[model samples]
Target chain A: MAALSPPYLLFLGDSDNPLSIKIARGLAHWRPELCIGETGGELSLGLKKMTPAQGARAGAKTFIVGLANGGGYFEPSWVGPIIAAIEAGMDIASGMHQKLSDHKEIRQAAQKHNVSLHDIRHTAAAPPLGTGVPRSGKRLLTVGTDCSVGKMYTALAIEKAMKQERLDVDFRATGQTGIFIAGGGIPVDAVIADFIAGAVEQLSPPADPGHWDVIEGQGSLFNPAFAGVSLGLLHGAQADILVMCHEAGRTQVKDMPGFPVPTLKDCIDTNLHLARLTNPAVKLGAIALNCRVLGAERADKHCAALSEQFAVPCFDPLLHGAGALAESLAGKEE
Target chain B: MAALSPPYLLFLGDSDNPLSIKIARGLAHWRPELCIGETGGELSLGLKKMTPAQGARAGAKTFIVGLANGGGYFEPSWVGPIIAAIEAGMDIASGMHQKLSDHKEIRQAAQKHNVSLHDIRHTAAAPPLGTGVPRSGKRLLTVGTDCSVGKMYTALAIEKAMKQERLDVDFRATGQTGIFIAGGGIPVDAVIADFIAGAVEQLSPPADPGHWDVIEGQGSLFNPAFAGVSLGLLHGAQADILVMCHEAGRTQVKDMPGFPVPTLKDCIDTNLHLARLTNPAVKLGAIALNCRVLGAERADKHCAALSEQFAVPCFDPLLHGAGALAESLAGKEE
Candidate 1:
């Protein structure tokens, strides 16, 4: 028998959530033969984890995981912790209350090997430079839940961070396409404008390898924007990475994968990780957040939990500062 | 008679365009005397100029003016030059090309004062920031024909320019009350959110004088949001001024004093100027054009004519740049 690729996904939600199913299916499609896991443990015992899983379906293990992204602790709340421990360096997003606060059994299991234990309930410190394109330098892109949420917030944070890093970065970057959540239907002007811009970009040659990163959000695979148009923007900008940022705890996903859209953020942590993942040629990067909006104390508690959970540093932009976060990310080079 | 306050506004629209009439009725229900535009140039001018005589009867426009706006340039043979003549500060905004440009006498008449020229034909040049905000230090709040025609563009331009000037401005300043351009109906959540947020701000002591601005765009007055909560948002964000942005030409605002909410590019200048004259204190600001999206070169000529005609700046934000235009507005202080 041929060797298999290790799993990198743990999908949540029920059948009613077509989006969750779509996500799982998307990963599987990219690399069939990937193992689907309803249950998981130290899959990499006494061995190093696989580096990249390209078409490896070869031996990847995907978890259907547990339900209750909204469930509490002491009540079989081992999903987040278990995934965290096994993933080790992997980033795991969690939902609901009481993360595995040192449960004897879970801790014992994690301690035996080099696995890590964490709980990813709170949202990302803020979004990271999701538009994965690394060669262009760190950039930001996001789709808002409304005109609010954290799109502008995170974008502004990154701008500040870039300034601190003293990088010759210009945050004047635009998706050329924007939308406002309303019943009147998608703003056709925005759609047309964005599409034309994207098409023009793809038809042009890349100025440099991974010249830019294009982060996008909102709409679903069914929506022309999420699928049809977004690609154009990413192509136009030569985005190196793709990031998606959203609140979790019980957030919903709505899409059919491979609509041709690139990387997306469903939770905060993954959103940050996405920044670094783009162009693996450079630093994958770290995360930034807001303590005031999220409540300083609460954010601190969550940041600690998430750091352990994802094995990546988590921060709040409003408190430690975007510049501070940037410094931390520099040290996270893979 | 008591001196009238400048808090009144007049909205004009047909089944196809109703913003004008809505603002009028809204004011009539409150302090009717301060509402409507009666005495000024439009009503006082000849046949082409018109206004809400009905609103006048209610004693709203004790200090009124006539300024009609619409979208005639969008029809068959209209072009940009003509649009320019109007938005350049064309007087009244209505009628077909046969009246303004085609008809020599009417074209000459359109050249008269008190009108603006230009249409929402092409984009502006310099962004509309310092110029758009009336006061360089003030923030922004706006509404457009719809969500698509450069609303956010204008806002962002203004924000960008302001930052360049070193103003420490905040946005959604109140985090609640925001300007809304009611269309068919408002969503309940939007209204509630605005209302709750507005209330919270109001309850709090006067803020420490923020340098930020709050702007909102409404979908509709009939929206569930309007009925329950958003109504308050509309009320809270409504400053002393209420200017309508329209695309107008002789063909658009037909039959004089026609329905407001002009759809062409040429009429914007005339519309804004008239709105201003109706209440000098809250006199209208200016107009931005979208020539490429609306008409042709003739409209541009007309828009330029209107600008010469009214002596008020009539421009296209995309082409002219929102900042350059907004910068000029610095001189218009009371």
Candidate 2:
């Protein structure tokens, strides 16, 4: 993480959509601000609403809207709440593919209000390709069975725990949400096909031998549509340690019905094998289970059983914290 | 290889430099156009020279200068020969780090002559990072023990042999000389560091499983300064089979002190170990020796001895040809 962003007003324009609902919930659980609220539809999360004046009073200087699947389209209907937030003197930060600055009325209002617009989806300057040169440091990448299966969440949790232990660690964000939290990172998916690994390399450059770079992983190798990007990142990251992430209740790959959810061991083996291509010493260090779907008791039992099976620490990052994984990493040889 | 350029008058400005001499000799050995002629110094190779008007008559539309270490600075003496060529109604194509098009005098003269200035150093659009997704086709990459050790030469020769055998093959050029002959390729070394591998990936995209892409490799892993680019290309190429290219009688790594030249077996093992990080199935297929230093008799004996030791067919691509290597590849199963 580089820069710390200002406190933000969470704006879930339409909470009925899956991407919007998921993001709103995730933000509340992770980075809860006193100024949290959703516009349009139902209030899906347990955060109280803040009036524009109240939000501003609470040091909320920016409005953040995290809506995936909404690529660069500013719907005509959601103008009121956004403009109201802008007029309240809050800058806007959006993770949607569409740029809010591109909206005619929104642009005019923001200009009048003198509020800055930060489109998280606006990709950074193209990154040079990874040299695949060996560097001094340990890089741990979180790989999953499918997309959005807690890879970023697990890495963030591990980073937080590592920091608590006073270990020199850094989080290398890859996707939009991770980038927003980290304050700086490339939107690897949006980059041209050739430079994916190069972009990852830029995000996580060589560091000191004692340092650990916790890289946020993207799509899974099992994902038919995005496996190339996954392989690119795997090689580009040049990771020495790997963490397998999986959603507890997933039975099949997201969007691909014919593909069964890969076993944790299989995923670990595949990842280790791929990672070894660039870093022959790469090894799977831990297993992270996203068990929000399963109750805490069930999640604990599942993790314990898997930990015993795989001979490694396994836990739900959010529920049980990342202590075991962080401890295992701290013991790793530089 | 994409677009075919008009025939050009090859210019070896001050052919004393190794790069200048190598390129001049290579062009003569391969693409021999009656229009081609060396200028600005002594003629080094055994190629017939043509007058500017005679070159034009022979369909030479441009003056091609392949100078390494020249960057973009045209020497004071070079101006005379270059301008003379331009005045003779010839466009200019240079593979120098500096842009001739940016040179005031060169630009003005080209403008006055109504000739286009092609600066090969002007990098193409930054390539996107690789997704590491699996494309359908089989790709073979030629890796080497050092720079300019016959990686490109071997790939080109193998491609030629494969095509003659009626196999579906494509030659993917990664450097300047290859790009010049191929007409359409990104000058990977000129590209920003991050996009090197991505650029290679773009040069060789996925195709049908039977389609084979012969990718030209770059720098050696043993070379400390350029290992990153080498590793990037190895992974980005997503090669299924790897061909090791080495020069005969080399005792040490080029320009790197205290580092002894690695054995062919060791080079193959190191390359396979790195390549397996991306494609687990990647295997070392053959060895191509650059035996120009050793004439025909010694070249064949050295290759035969190395072949007996490595258990892989080894040959000087220019002399004995790449028939064995191509045949071995043709027999490979997907």
Most TM-score-accurate candidate: 2
Error of 1 at A183 (Å): 33
Candidate 1 C-alpha lDDT tens digits along B240-320: 232223333322122212222334332333223222311224433444454554556755675587566545455565555
Whole-model lDDT for model 2 versus the true structure?
Answer: 0.74
RMSD of each candidate relative to the true structure: 25.8, 6.4
- Report the CAPRI category for model 2: incorrect
- Per-residue error (Å), model 1, residue B215: 3.5
Tens digits of per-residue lDDT for model 2, B113-148: 898777665654767654455668989999998877
Model 2: chain A TM-score against the true structure: 0.86
lDDT of 2 by residue, A139-168 (tens): 989999888898999998989888887789
User: Residue A30 in model 2: shift from native, Å?
Assistant: 2.6
Q: What is the TM-score of each candidate against the true structure?
A: 0.25, 0.70
- lDDT, candidate 1, A1-334, per-residue tens: 0111245443333234443233233333322333333222322112222322221233433222223422344345344545443444332222224544356765554465444333333211221111212233443444322222344345445555655665433332222111100000122112222132222232222344322232333322112112112222322333332323223231222331222222223233222322222223222233333345466678878667755654545556455545644455344332
| Ten contiguous residues minimizing lDDT sum, candidate 2 chain A | A33-42
**Individual DockQ of the candidates?**
0.01, 0.07
CAPRI-wise, candidate 1 is: incorrect
